[model samples]
Target: VTGSPGAVITLDTTAGVVFQLNPQTFPALDMAGADDIHLRNLSGSEFSTSVNLVADITTLADGVTPIGNNKYFNLVIWGGQNRTGQTSHLYCNLPIGQYGKQGDAIVDAEKFSVHTIPNDFRGVGFLIGELTFQFSSGGGGTWALIQERVLLGHFPILIPGGGTTTIISTFVDSSFEIFGNLDDTKRIAFQADSITTGTTRIITMADVNVDLADIATNNAKVSNVTHTGDVTGATALTLDLNNLGTETSIASGDFLAMVDITDSGSEKITFDNLQANIVKTGALNSGSITSGFGNIDIGSSTIDAGTIDGTAVTATTQLVSNIWKDINALDVKAEYTGSQTGHADFDGTDDSVSIADREEYDGTGVF
Candidate 1:
């Protein structure tokens, strides 16, 4: 059952309802790409960012109130899959959550993550299996699940891909394993000969990965911040990039965030330039700029602290962005005809470094 734009879906157990899906017409095999079930909620209240499919669900947040608003779930590869003796996972893409802002409309907790399948059953075939789910509130606790029988499918359509920065994220139970050779499951990928939005093809590496055993928060360009798991941090997958555009620097404070990680609080990677020409605002404020560290009320002198080690800065957490890291290995070579004017003004100042957030692997984990 898929709820389209302006559609409403409700689950009232008292109504004697059992949701059904189109059966697979192909051979029955575990994890085989056969028939799939799709359930989406374009407008269903009662649902929150997280849903617990372990119980009647009526007692968990939404009660019996509708719960799925702009949410979705997919039961893929529904056929002779022997998942009876194991557990499969379904990640939650509560992009806006119940707290998401639709166009200009606002709702508190409408994006329900946990969806009720009416009964503990799914698909139509001789190998149809039982389905169950649980909810997660990323604000705290464990929602990142891992090291088990998992079916990673049904990605959320909430990712805004039009702009320069495309955002896509999902929440899972604690200790979720992202890297490993799969056995009973296969990560089915959708291939696009020429993927484009409106009339333009996507191009560019916007941010860092969130689930690389580095932290739990979505990487919005962090360096070495440490966060051990949910509520604290997140892990991320590898970045899949190609033909992305290029960004260059050749002026003073041209790249904001050069040394200051403004989003994750006031975590600054400062640099001390003997020449006291300091900048205090904009993107190159912390890491991007090679010299300017932004000008602020620094004691009695608005000086240029542009030489301090600016390496300890970590990434800021984002809700709907997935984590993918850059590939940096020895012997990797590259070249670019950077614009002569594409650099931040050095102002003839030698810079010093000030690393922030104790390196994630430092002997002592202290910021």
Candidate 2:
């Protein structure tokens, strides 16, 4: 008989009742992914789904609720039904008992890593507090043939004062071992610690990897400093010393040197006596002189053979030596003038001639 919404169903035992157990598809539970689930009573008063559940859920019913939120009596949890075990793939919310209220079961004393499956019966078997387990038939009748089968079971655990325990199992207790992939495995390990005065003790994993881009923090100012790295592709760099007090000089061992110009069109170092410094250097690589300038000072400077490219060149010693050598080569002899002015006759011209007489006979021959 199908347990559909309008289907007839019956209750077992001597005190029988004919009614449905609300088989209207209790929405499936979700796997706990990076979260934890807290168990509480059926009133939904002190329950927390965070840090406990990993997926979206439908009904968070406590299987042990005795028709109401009565802590004294025991409760029953009829196995949820699904054709292909679709509804039972997620974990159940077990009660987290207090220190004094927790039972002697091993799973209750410590944190349990729970595994869930799609099957109605999970491989997990644990006892907490006063909760008990019982099996049922799909037809609402007694299935005595499968009574010896251990569908779910729990054992006692002796835990240390402060330690951790890991629980690893499949979702349902079944003889089938179809899951061979390690991705579907679940291990829920929990650690216990002692709390300080005002601080609550909790377990934390070290070395957490996080996406720093998601964090919103202060924008820090980075200082100007040289960073050391591999010297493979670094070709050029510039440095500005405008804020420095005095002139900075590069030391001998310093190989890399560069200067950055000011952005306001101002020169870094403006030399006033640029021409004077050029004169002191004596030789210019390639330069031109100013038009209508003073004398060219090639004085006592031994220029290279093919260095001078100008047309005219004159100097003190050069003028004196040339004039004296020409005058000394002239041959002069004695000569007589009109009355008695004895004169010396040069090789071709008169050596002695009166200043006034020479001017008077300028148009004619020499007198």
Q: In model 2, where is the ten-residue run with the lowest total lDDT?
A: 142-151
Model 1 regions more than 4 Å off: 1-68, 75-367
lDDT tens per residue, model 2, 8-122: 2111211111122432332333222332233333235333433312121112243332211111111111233343334321123333221111121222332322222223233
Cα lDDT tens digits for candidate 1, 23-61: 222322221122222222223432222222211222223
TM-scores of the candidates are 0.15, 0.16
Report, for every candidate in turn, its global Cα lDDT versus the true structure: 0.26, 0.28
